[model samples]
Target: MTETITRTTGSADVRGLSRWTAAVILPIGPAAVALLRYFLPYDTVDDSSTMTSKVMAEPGRMSLVLWLGFIALLTLVPAAYSVGRMTRRRAPLLTAIAMFLVVPGYLALPWLAGTDQLLWSGTEAGLDANTITRLAETPHPTVAVAGVFFVLGHVLGTILLGMAMWRSKVVARWAAVAVIVSQPIHFVAAVIIPNHTLDLIGWGLQAVGFAVVGWAILRLRNDDWDLPAVA
Candidate 1:
């Protein structure tokens, strides 16, 4: 019986630690991305050569931006996982589906970031911008597929996770709504309108939403944050 109680206590401790870790990390990725957008403000509609030129013009700033982007990508999966954990009890299926979508989507980001490095290297080598652009834009079918997955996964997955959070009632309705609407705004700002200010605002909303959620999690007792272990 003593061993059994010890096992139960250990389980509870692990669960509590997991919840705390998740809450602490949830806002990091989006906040980093928002900062990146604010600092870099790269024009998405520019051709590869133009974009490369812009990066070359400010190599120091570009390096910072790249690091920020890397941080955002690194933390995204954990942020998504936190959302899944928050909603799982009340909206298991939705959380499951969102995780399925976001894991692959977030994982694909590093692959896409390779373009930035390639462009920077090409410029440093004094390669023709047009030639570098052509090489970068080479129609690799695998990359094309990953791009599709990345787009659909992040946008759709985030929306679904927000819905799950709403259904769970773990966070305020406004916070959940903020999370839900953020991605659509990001999509429009980054793709359709290509406004850096709007992109910053969009990612800012996500950061705000996750910040609130993290606060709520912090306020919960360990037992409330996760199921108590039964001896």
Candidate 2:
């Protein structure tokens, strides 16, 4: 008879992917937020504007690109690893579905922001223009173009995220709920109000999401405990 092995390998694998996702993906939102907030200001077109398209263009675009890339990569990563970790345990396909949704949602962020960025690129000042100039020059982004994703992705994604975290308890349950609630707030603003309305709320909510996930990854880093082997 062959010796059978039942270890936390499945959990371990998902855990690894989760850690990787947390390290790379979680930081993306905050990184973009920080970069824009600190370096790029609100895009002034004044001659006094020091930053140029060449400067902010690369960093800003790269942030969106990399963030989306990570999100896409993670969609495949988590779904594959989750099938095994969650098999016969709980969540079943929901785990994979939730994991996969992250990609589309991420892609949506750049798509929505693309118009503004492209237009800004045409000018000497990309993201360093004065608020009034930027508002007057740029078209007030369309509904279908950028609004939908901003509403659905963040809102639904947050709900699924809360469920995922709650189901797995990878991070504390309440922390997941905290992230979940922000989605509606983001979605409502995107759907009805102006984008600027969500500036602080969106950033603050995302900050919480990152903090919780990052903390979970750090705690699990040294863990090698196997679920099956425990008993």
Question: Which predicted model would earn the best lDDT?
Answer: 1
Ten residues in a row with the worst lDDT in model 2?
Answer: 79-88
Error of 2 at 171 (Å): 2.0
Q: Which clashing pairs does model 2 show?
A: 43-127, 43-128, 43-129, 43-130, 44-128, 44-129, 44-130, 45-129, 45-130
lDDT of 1: 0.81
The number of the candidate with the highest TM-score is 1
lDDT of 2 by residue, 71-156 (tens): 44344233323222422135545555655554455556555455434434545343444552444345455536555654555456
Q: Each model's TM-score?
A: 0.87, 0.52
Model 2 lDDT on a 0 to 1 scale: 0.48
Q: Write the per-residue lDDT of candidate 1 for residues 88-178, one digit (tens) a residue.
A: 9899999999889978998887777777767767767888778778878874677778888888888998889889889999899999999
